[model samples]
Target: MRRSEEQFRILVQGVTDYAIYMLDTSGHVSSWNIGAERIKGYKQHEIIGQHFSRFYTEEDLNEGLPDIALATAFRTGRYEKEGWRVRKDGTRFWANVIIDAVRNDDGELIGFAKVTRDVTERMNAQKELAKAREALFQSQKMEAIGQLTGGVAHDFNNLLMAVLGSLELLRKRISADPRALDLLDNAVEAAQRGSSLTQRMLAFARRQDLDLQTVDLPGLVDNVADLLERSIGPAITIDMRFPARLPNVTADPNQLELALLNLAVNARDAMPNGGKIVISAREATVAGGDPDMAAGRYACLSISDEGEGMDKETLDRAIEPFYTTKGVGKGTGLGLPMVHGIMKQSGGQLVLRSEPQKGTTAELWLPVAQEQEITAPVRAMEVQATPEKRALKVLAVDDDALVLMNTVAMLEELGHEVIEASSGQDALGLLEQNPDIDLVVTDQAMPRMTGTQLLGHIKERSPSLPVILVTGYSELPKDFSKVPLLSKPFMLSQLSKKLAEALSSAAAAPDEDAAEAPAS
Candidate 1:
């Protein structure tokens, strides 16, 4: 019997995972096993006389949990729970613990037995799983929003094209009357602003085509300084600073300008009492270990505002779409989100720093590239070709009636033979029936068939027929070979430019691929 008791004691003392120990009736540790020492980071001598409460966190101890657990165990003969517990090194862990009342034959309590197991690893794994699930949900939500935004942009562009075309025609017809002309000009200006707003929405939705190229940061900031100053008014002072010979970055200059304008506007609003705005730029290196920045040289552009800054909670969610503190009708809550999308799409990073009562600073880190001077091509004076002599049989296709009529009017006004088709099928039939058709201009978004699909069909049959696909959404298949693109809401001059370019290319020797053309 004694040998068996000794063997059992040895088995209990050999454990190193669970913290198995004994506590006296007074709640002081009375005996310690090797498992207790290993799990709790304490030696037998050091912990034997210590109170069992030492294993609990301060918050638990303050709530008299040690005494309560002892009372529960003594009365009910057991206690079990899992929660955060402290170790000898002050590190906290999720721990599973159990206590049992020890007693004599008569059931009088003598002491208590305790066991604890650290479960921090399991807790961390669970947290990571939850985070991944949330991230997946957010990704799906953004994709849905993108689809919706693209559909709306397509419809909006059709309406805008009609409004813009009418305004352009009206300006010419009413130019003789100064009062009427002024009204037309104002309407045109408003329509242009609306076009810009639509583009901004596309930016936020990450659908806008980003024209990334080498850009001189110093020159860009200098050119925009006057505009920024005028826009913000004299009440707020504007300052510019740049390091000598800052490296050029790869970005879309126009989009960067818009982003800067957004930041300036936001800064101005933040400082309703008027304050200083500082625009600064420098070339810096992102270290390899940075989690958010790739290891490379970058042009760091920072905009600082001396205004009431955001608190921690606001700063945390500042980049979320449609989230804003601005009251209704004052903001669409897209400025920061759009800027953030721009940064990500540009292969860069955005850093925002703000503190309550202090000012805010927004930083854009654009990847730096090898120094390359960009030169613009000089155009020779064109012998003005009369549209009537250069006129070709043109096909204009669009689903919207008003837009199709506007396009026909514009084509006829340019002295070309206009053929109208409302569907891609109609366009194909027109091409089949009319062998004299010179060019095909088709809208991309349609009911049954898209312009790209129509382009493919036309190319298969008439290999050399020049096709121009018009779209507002700034994405297309990679294999859209040799086809030209024209953006919606185009004016006569813009249409003329695309047509002239396409006609010139079509007149060349048989080419298998359409020449890559820029959208106007």
Candidate 2:
């Protein structure tokens, strides 16, 4: 019996992964092994006579957890749990613990046998795994939302195109009737507003077509100063702090201006009692510093507002589409999301920082435009009636009946002979039957085959024939950008302009690979 007891004691002392120890009836450490000394950072002599509760944290001790644990073990024969525990040096670690009741041969309780295992690394890894899962879920949710928003916006744009085009044509026909013309003008204005809304939706989906340019940031802000003043009311002040010279940024000037206005309006709305909004700009070099932004030189345009800031929860979801804190009808909730998408498409990022009782700051970071990348702005010409150019036989194609009818009307109104097809396959068949067709205008999103697919077929049959691809969003493949494009919901004059440009360019540069396509 004595030899067997000695072997058991040696076995208990040899365990290095677990802190093995024994306590007296009063919960004082009565025995300690080598494992206990190594794990707890205390010698056996230092801990053997001390109270075992010393291993508990201050919070646990205040809760009387050690007494509860011992009582539970004594009554139930064993107690097991996982929680935070403290070592001798006062550092906390996740611990898996077990306390077994020790009793004499007569079944009277004497003390407890305690065992503890450190599991801090395992707990940390579990937390990291949970975070990764949450991140993946968020990414997938956003992608689904973007896809839905883009599709709906594209369909809305087509509807707006039909409404706007038909209204313009009717207005022209009834120009002499004052009442009729006024009503038509109002209808046109409403449709134009809807068109603008769809554009914002597309922007939020990161699918809008942008007219990118190297813009002078300070100058653009200066131009909108009066507009900003009128928008935010007299109570609010617009403070601009820009240096004398700053690097130009690559962006769509109109869209960037709109994004700025949206942010400014958001800031103005935040400060209901009136406050100063500060707009500033500075140069920054990002080298793996921010996870959201790429490493490059950027012009950081910051807009800050003195208002009641958002809490962490609100700030975290600020860029989610359709999430708003404003009263009913006061906001659409797409402002921040649109700006976020625009910044991303422009090779930049939008960052927002806010704290309770302080203020909110929005940073619009844009890539600096190199000197060679800057393109001179084209001078705009006043819209006028189409010039007396030679009329050509035109093929207009669209799957939507309303859009197709409106497009045919516009083409005939411009004095071009129109032959319409409802689908790409039908258009191809028509081309085969009519070799004399001079040009083809097709909507990009269609059934059977898309506009680019039709253009490819036409290029194979007749590379010199002109083709104009019209779209509501940026759906064209990058390589096909060289093909002429006209945005949807276009006015009569815009369509006329696109037609003339396509024809003239085709004539001027016949050898350009993407300039011409076969109509027949």
Candidate 3:
């Protein structure tokens, strides 16, 4: 029996991965093995007579946990848990612990056998895994929201097209009547506002068409500085901190300008007491270190404000669509989300850093453009005076009846004979019936047959015929750039310009084999 006991003691002493020890009835350390000395950083001579409660944390001791643990083990024969525990040097580690009640022949508890294993590394890994899962879930949820917003924006833009188009045409007819013109103008303004709302929504969904250009960061900020100053009001000073030689970035000049203004205005709003807003930029080389950004050289533009900053919760949700912290009517929560989408679509990322007392900094990470020099922004073609051209038969197609009617009206107003088709198939059937139809103007989002499909069929049949694709949001083919595109909710002048451009191009290039080719 003595040799068996000696072998058991030797076995217990051999374990260095776990701290194994014994406690007296009163929870005093009675026996300490080599494993206990190694894991707990204590010598057996130093710990054997010490109270086992010394191993517990201060809070645990204050709660009388040592006594409770011993009592539970005595009553239940064993107690097991995982929690934060302190080592001899007072450093905390996550520990898996077990305390088993020890008894003699009479079945009375004499002591407790305690075992503890440090599990800090395991706990930290689990925490990281949980964070990764949460991040994935958030990404999926945001993607779903973006899709829903994009769909809604598409439908809304179509409706606005009908309303705004009708109001624009009505204003031309009612220009002589001051009161009627005023009401029409008001209606037009309201419709335009709704159009703006849809544009922001589309921006957040990353579906907004961008006019890409090489933008000089310093020059763009200079151009918008006065405008931003006016928008944010006095009291706040705009400070520019661009390096003398910063590379231009590739982005839509107008959209990037708007994004900068939005971020500036956000900073202005954050500071009610009036503070300096610092706008700075630098070139940064990103390795695969950042999770949100791919490896590339980036022009990092930062807008920082000294204001009451956001808490972690607020900062976490700052880019959520339509989540505003400002007073109602003072803000639209889409500003940040819109900026976020623009950066994403521009092959960049928006990173916001904030602390509750230290204010906030919004960083716009835009990919560096190949062109070192800033190029001039392409100006929109100005609507010229009506030029003499032979009016031709035009086929107008749309799924929405109101939009079709308005489009037909606008076409007829432009002196073109209009034939309306409610769908792409109907448009094709009409083309078959009316072979003389000189041009096809079609909406892209239609039931049964999409505009791209119709364009495909038209190309297969009449390679030289010109077709103009009008859409709220484009999901066209790779060769779509060859085809003329007109965005929805356009003004009459814009439509006329597109018509002229399309017709003129078609007239100029008659022999191109693609259906996207223009007629002779």
Candidate 4:
């Protein structure tokens, strides 16, 4: 009998080191130990016979946590959790808790054995770490976006300045005979093409207005075959493969074609001596496949090039903006990055596969549009008209002296009287002096005042004035509904068309003076 008593004392003392205690079936504190008093800030005399739920918060009590815990322990033979627990002083600490059912040998329920440990410091540290990580991620994302926006804007402006400058020069020299006029025409055409290219860049950068459509993937590829053949040169072979019944993808058809062309150009550059390029399309259902691919029907367009492919490091950073493997002046690192941005914005994904000396394949997965979402009569590019013998007053502005002079010359050659200004402020002054200014043409980014600011001022003063804004920047501030925009690097014809359109719209407006005039 003495030996059994000694063993019981040893067992109680061993459990005292671990905050071990006992609870009745009703969840009352049937017994307490030294460890429980140490951890919970309670004395054995003070806690014994009290409800075990005193260890829980008032919120837990209202939610019947004690009853739920007991029921869980009864059903599963144990209940375990790590959370906040109340102490004797009404303070809370992070706790690791375990409650085990205590049963007699005859299988009758007696009570529960409960154990707890304070872990507040560790829990708080973990929460702080998670918050810090989230903040860092957000900061990095914003920084990356800012860098991309700036790079795109700089490149766009440079291209526009070149085209617009050239067009202006061509306009001034049109009277230099038929040969000179032909050269000017060619220069203007090239500038116009450059403007189209910039517009594509803006589209990929998600800054352009998009007219989304349900596009037949195979048909689009087929249409571009002739253009691809001419653009890629005779050294490269072009091939297309498609399944008969492929799903239509929802996208801007022109943008999609441009994306394909960009990819093809990249592929062409990869193969200096030339190689075979294959364009293929197929329907795919990606359920439980790649995590990035998602679960849905997609139109998969793949472009493969036999060229000097890239390694793992290059491939990893390939989608990053301004990252290029090509030599200086050979490429703008925006090609693939723009493709990536377009895919992301279009509810799709771009996958690239490559290996050094092996070749490269880029796959574009676009979501399939529903039948009802498909619209009739796809939007196609309209043919522009040639400039006619018409004399009109025009106002043009740019920060660069050369660009300003060239634009003035171009407007004059188109049989229009040209007024030029070097800045928005100068342009505003010009507008004030010449109320007969048929069109308000201005550059976007400049010193003193921005193009958007000038546009706002002009709208306020002369709401009926046909204002045409030109920008080399990829991004425009919100609210551009009041004016027509012409991207930089435009041809003389492009300017003419825009001016014509602005005049048309202005003429269409109901004239208050006419309405007030005696019905003539």
Candidate 5:
């Protein structure tokens, strides 16, 4: 029975997953088991007499960890800890270790029993979980900011439109007095600047209308070469390695140029003392083999800077809205986020790679658009007259008093008779009174009834009446399939053009219009 008991103890000690061993009072390995061999990538012959400190990192060893463990075990009768430990192959692992002092009948220390378990996989999984949690938090915060920015941008655009529109009329009426013209010029410039700032906010919110087109990647880069050189001081060198032929990507040319400029400026900032920036372009195909990218032909544009790179934590949050490392007033923290939003809106992706000492690289992946589908020479707004006479009665609805008045004035200027409403409810009443109203232009967001709802009511009453929905908010309701939409703060010519097109289309499709009369 005694022999059998000893054999059973040995059998348990030989198990490979739980490393079992014995250490002397001085913390030197006295005996080793098969488990220790497997866990530490060692054999009994090699590690039986070695000091346990060999399993710890050099820093830990220098800190006298081996002696501390023995002292702790001696004082408390047992010691346990979990920390980084080295394996025989020079790899590090998370290890849970326990040491218990063993003594003889006389109460003299004999040895110590040690048990260790490899927990590296669990440690790594926990790290990954932490990263996922951080990413989720950032995404939620960005969504909240997006909603706030969108609303604020919408309101500001209405105000700017009113100011600019009134100015346009004033400019046309006033004589060319140098002083008056100069003052007007300044006001116009300020209003234009305000418009630009609002547009940037819209871009960050990903709500701006994109004039997407297929563009040659290299050509676009070349066009901005001079500007980039001027933007980044003469101390820094700008290098280009554009391929002879690159894939054409579908994107808004202006936005793409802005994105590139943002990236270049960021790169320049990183290199305060001046460094080289390499701009390169090439064609790439992401098949299933690449995990981060989708399967498609892509135009890859990369900007690399030999500057001070960001650490892991900073790089992770680099694209987040309002996250900037620069000093206050030095940065807005919206540039990279704007770039990210633009890429997402354009059906592309942006990725950043950086290391503490290895510098940084930003790559934009834009899916190649078909050559035939590419629009040539992007069109600007053109004023055209409608075939039908301007004698048609039009109803315009907007919550802003100034916007409504300005819109009415523009319509009257265009030789159309106009009826105005401060809200959707008022517009509905006017429409009910005059069923002969030829067109209904309504704002999307209003107090009582939304433009969408008002349009639905009107459609139900008269299917042939052309309805145009305008809003500073660009996103349309999902069900508004065939509805004509005009973005808010629009130029008078744009509004007139859109109104004409909607009316003409309605006139041509009388049969379909009657079938789907109600916009509900």
Candidate 6:
């Protein structure tokens, strides 16, 4: 029996993975095993006779938890807990600790036997796993939202195209009666608003098809200044500052313009009493970028207003889609989020700075282009009545009956002879038989044959003939942008503009592979 007891003592002293020690009745360390010395970062001589509370954190000691732990063990015979414990070196560990009351055979309390095991690795693993799960869930949710918004926006655009085109044509035909024209104009305006909403929806989902072009910063800013001031009202003065030279940016200028307009309107609304808005542009380069942008050289366009700003919570969620603070029907809650999505889609960033009572400043960072040759965009003409309307034979093709009829009506209203087809195959057949057809305007998403495929065949047969593809979807397959494009939900004025561009391309030397497309 004595030999077995000796072996037991050696076994207890040999272990080094845990801290095994004995505390006196007063909660002072009385004995320390080899494991206790190894795990607590202390020598047996250094730790023995010290208070057991020395192994507890400063916070735990202040709360008298060390004394309570001993009292509980003496009363209940055992105490067990998992928490952060301190080592002699002042480092912390997630420890699984247990203390048992030790008593003599006579049932009198003698001391306490304490055991501690480090569990930091296991705790860290659990936390990391939870974090990963949360990230995955967030990603899946955003993807689902993207798919839903993208599909709804596509269908909505197709309908808007039909509505907008018909309204524009109707407004022109009923011009004599002022009362009738005013009512028609109202309907047209409402339809245009709907079209704008659909575009914002697509923008929020990051599914708005982009028509990227190299644009000069100063020129673009100067061009939009008049429209910007007119929209913001007379109370708010506009200030513009730009350097003589700035790098051009690659972006969809129309979309960027709309985004800036949205910001301006937001600023106007914030300052009911009126305030000055500053529009500034300069060169910028960022390295190891923040969460919203990549590292690149950019043309920084900033819009600032001295008006009401946002608080922390509001600012944090400001860019979330459909989360507006404005009253119902007052705002769609999509302006900032759409701007955010556009900046990201364009490989740039949108940074908003605001304080509760101060004001707000929005910065649009657009990536710089490396190309030297800059092509000036064709200026859009706004003419209600053309002096000389082109009277040419045109082919209009679409899968949807309403949209096809709308296109045909607009062509007829413009005094062009309309040849209509409901499918790309039908349009192709018509083109082959009618060699004198001046232009072809077709829908993109047609069954069996797409607009691009038809354009491929048409180019092979008659490469020089002008053709325009109209669609709700802006994005197309690689190298499919050669034929001129007219975006869906367009007004008669837009239709007239694209038609003129196509008609003039016959005289000018165009890109050998691709035709210019409508940009937004």
| Most accurate candidate by lDDT | 2
The pairs that clash in candidate 4 are: 160-489, 168-406
The local distance difference test score of model 1 is 0.83
- Point out where model 6 deviates above 4 Å: 1-27, 31-129, 175-178, 209-254, 260-317, 351-368, 371-389, 506-520
Q: Relative to the unseen true structure, what is the C-alpha lDDT of residue 153 in candidate 5, on a scale of 0 to 100?
A: 86
lDDT of 5 by residue, 413-441 (tens): 66788999998889888987987788988
Off by over 4 Å in 5: 170-184, 222-238, 268-276, 285-297, 307-314, 323-331, 355-359, 370-373, 381-392, 413-415, 478-484, 496-520
Please state the error at residue 288 of candidate 2 in Å: 5.9
Question: Model 3 clash tally?
Answer: 0
Question: What would the per-residue lDDT of candidate 6 be over residues 13-44, giving only the tens digit for each residue?
Answer: 88889888889999898878888887788898
The estimated TM-scores of all candidates read 0.84, 0.86, 0.91, 0.58, 0.85, 0.76
Give lDDT: candidate 3, residue 120. Answer: 92
lDDT of 3 at 466: 88
RMSD of 4: 13.8
User: How many steric overlaps does candidate 6 have?
Assistant: 3
lDDT of 1 by residue, 1-520 (tens): 9999999889889988888888999999998899887777888888888998888888998898988998899889999988888778998889998999999999888999998888889889999899889767766776676567666766787889999998887676664887888788898898887786677667767777777778888888888888898888888898888887787898888789889998998999989999999999988888897756789999899999999999998997787667889999888777887787688778897799999878899999999966576544222235343333478899999989999998898888888898999999999998888989989889988888999999889879987788888888676676874567788878888788788767666667354233555445
Rank by TM-score (best first)? 3, 2, 5, 1, 6, 4
TM-score (C-alpha, index-matched) for candidate 5: 0.85
RMSD of 3: 3.4
**Per-residue error at 171 for model 3, in Å?**
1.5
lDDT of each: 0.83, 0.89, 0.88, 0.78, 0.84, 0.84
Candidate 1 Cα errors over 4 Å, as ranges:
171-190, 235-247, 276-300, 311-313, 349-355, 370-389, 459-465, 507-520
> What digit string (tens of lDDT, one per residue) describes model 2 on residues 442-510?
999997799999999999999889999999999999989888898888988888888887887677775
Report the C-alpha lDDT of model 4 over 1-520, residue by residue, as the tens digit.
9999989767875664467888998888877777788789998889888988888888888999889999999999999988778888888998898999999999888999998878788899999899889758755773566456656755655656666666565466558688877877787676666665555455446566455688888878888889888888999998889887887888877778878988999899989999999999888888975546668899889999999999998997787656789999777677886777677668888899999999999999998988734566445346353444578888888887756776676677678888888888888899999998878778777888988888888989998887777766534665775466776665677777877877766766657557777965
Report how far residue 135 has shifted in candidate 6, in Å.
3.0
Question: Against the true structure, whose TM-score is highest?
Answer: 3
